[model samples]
Target: MKKKLSPIIAVSLFLAVISLLFPPSSMAGEERIQQELRDPNPTLNPLQKALGKKGYDRAMASGKYRYVGNTKCRLCHREFFVGRKKDPHVYTYERLVAIGYETNKRCLGCHTTGFGVPTGYESFEKTPKLVGVQCEGCHGPGSEHVRLHRDDASPFGMGIPRPRPQKPKGGKKEIKGGFLAGADNPRIIKRMCLSCHTKRWGRSFKRTPHAFQAAYDLYKTPLPGDEGDQ
Candidate 1:
């Protein structure tokens, strides 16, 4: 009494039924996009918590100090190690290569610590192993002070972080970086953020706020198969 359906017609009808039964995935994807659009990179607020330009200028001057290599800085900063072969900052050099750069002294000057070194030792093999900006890279070398701190003797340089005034009751300071807050010396952390950003950038920032943000501490980042701490 009824006409038989073609095989193609049966498959199309089956797909239509399945589409009606199952919900479309576009709605959820759109919700995720809206959420990201609302507050992408919430942690960034230059006007609220920037280290400022003056802070970075003084920070870069430390590179011209006695020039203790990165290995020396690692002595105090071993806790933040990423366990990689090259220096954490050396990784930036690889990025430059992608855009056609050589490991020349001019390049390494900013890429590595002792790049534009005045001592006539600018080559990587010849320079200190601590290329790129480091804790001491901006905070000045600690060789004179590390022992002093341990011995409770006279302080070494002016780079030590002075004590902050006691916070008033119910008022909290939203500090940056766990290490920056945890450091016995905040100057080391501040200068670390300043070395690269202390360029001719202040004039442009007057129009809009863009604080310096540092992301070099690899240990703090999440690893494979590990759920990150939120």
Candidate 2:
């Protein structure tokens, strides 16, 4: 008589076969992230670390905004999206891939939009639309912003007027329509940029005092058809 496989071993073998056939991309991505989290080295980014996991989780959960990726942003900001193709930020994730750190959680925070957060980038296979440092990376999550604008643009739209900008409370800057206005919040923008552009990363923020401002200027440069809008 042939020896019977143990229940645990049989279940494992069955799942392995199923995975081979179905190839759960999202599950694989989650597993990859979990694996990185289990590693001895720290995986959370500077901002995430500052918040602490629980604090960060709470902020993301309470925000009620989701990352809609660059594709959604392109619907309205076509010029900016097209213009960004020439910018180096568009290829940030490819840079990591070239260096064989594509799945490195430590680097993903800067390399990809919204990594390690809710509704954020997972693996390229799972969240290909969010592969690079897109608009949401700097502007914060755009789900609410996109939804509001899209509803306003609808032909059968309700005639409800957009909400007036509310005064920020508690000295905390308020994001309008679920988006952080980077131009209006220079300090926040600078902090976001420097979170990744640290001395340890060989960024010239310290060596060149004006580097951040210069980059910010470049970031805000209007595309050919965007001058009047700006």
Candidate 3:
């Protein structure tokens, strides 16, 4: 069998492969250039508007955010459940119950959100056992991230609950407190730490130092056959 080929076809294929191999914008021409880049936080994105410093505090004080209980989170995150029973955070919940805390009161504060708030519970019995620090508790609301998963697939880890594998956004960049050698978007990772770390009201992330870095440094989740990278 003989296959017909043209010189133009061969040259195009070679260029396509070369582009994929060296995806740096330096040689790809102005097609990849952006004179006025769109900010990561577009106006449409609610996280930027709601959590900003200007007036985010006022809305939080009035109980504007949703109260998705821990039970909702434990529906799928049974793995994290193993540690919660023993973690001190659960004990804090028990303490709150012993002291006679109000039932209608919002204990969700301790269970999720609020920066500087230690792992504790205002009530043990009142709050669901599976709810404390579930995936969404720390990783922002699941509404958008979940929906995005349908089309884009933003899994928590390598198709698993806990014990995440390495997902370095930046390839090799010096991020905030350390050098994240594999973080693709080091800056975004830094912003994520504070969804629970030191959150201020609706403020999601005030200062994401390593927003852009190598993918390796952000998360060190080991893929099944990636012993060499470690």
Candidate 4:
């Protein structure tokens, strides 16, 4: 003759047992980014300070930029904003978390937007909005561009200004700033995609109807909400 446990007591005991098997850090809902910042691994020195002020010191030192998140970009590029919401890249972090690699420093580099860049994803706690491959991930940080546009509305002025080339000292060709938007170029765009979609990642995309294509090309394809010739 033993006394039966109450419903509440039974549930509490079950939860306690589960907690012992899986610590709070292993909990699916936990924001592991914060914990990783707290416990910096010596071998992974760069990541230990990922969320620290000094981590982004170099980026900020330039005083030209910071990651303003996709939402900020949405104010201007509404169509692209809508399109990106449906893109698989938007859910990169979610996919990582689903596979329990959300805390893996190596995986986070590609999954997150502006991982090590200034004003990039610090902790989900601090910059949850910046999570996943975002507009800044490809277009580069928008702070400088945004600042320029907010001050003026000229086409030439709104973009990152092509720096004046230095004069040739010894008849050598001057080096120019690299192009910003390479999404339009088939060759350059493939490199951008391969940054994350390497053989190790097991992403084997063919040119079939359902196969992968650059986002710019995919944007041209007709979709449900799009108008004719879109």
User: Highest TM-score, which number?
Assistant: 2
TM-score of model 3 relative to the true fold?
A: 0.31
C-alpha lDDT of residue 212 in model 1: 30
**TM-score: model 4 vs. ground truth:** 0.53
Q: What TM-score should be assigned to candidate 1?
A: 0.38
Estimate TM-scores for all models.
Answer: 0.38, 0.65, 0.31, 0.53
lDDT of 1 by residue, 1-230 (tens): 89899899999999999876543532343453354336434322121123444642443343422445555445444433434343444465555455554354334444444344333225546654554555444334444334333333223322345444343355323112212122444544454444443332122223324323223232243221122321
State model 4's lDDT.
Answer: 0.54
Better of 1 and 2 by lDDT: 2
- In the range 1-230, model 3's lDDT, one tens digit per residue, is 79877889999999999887754433332232121123242222222233454433443443323334455445444334544554343443344355453232333443333222222223445435333443333333333223223333333422454432333357223221111111343344345433323322222122244432222242333221232243
Give Cα distance to truth, residue 213, candidate 1, Å.
5.7
**RMSD of each predicted structure:** 13.8, 16.9, 21.2, 12.6
lDDT of 4 by residue, 1-230 (tens): 89899999999999999987765535343344444345443113122133234523544576766678877666654556544556667888998778687767655766887676657786678889988887666545667556644543334331455434333346222111111222333443354455555433323353344445543456453231243334
lDDT of each: 0.40, 0.66, 0.36, 0.54
Segments of candidate 2 deviating more than 4 angstroms: 1-43, 46-58, 152-172, 223-230
lDDT by residue (1-230, candidate 2, tens digit) is: 99999999999999999987645432444465455457576535544543456745665767767889887776655557556666777898998898588997777988898887778899988999988887887776788667656644533233345554454455334354445434557665666676665533424344366755666677775442233333
Give candidate 3 misplaced runs (Cα > 4 Å). 1-78, 102-108, 111-134, 151-230
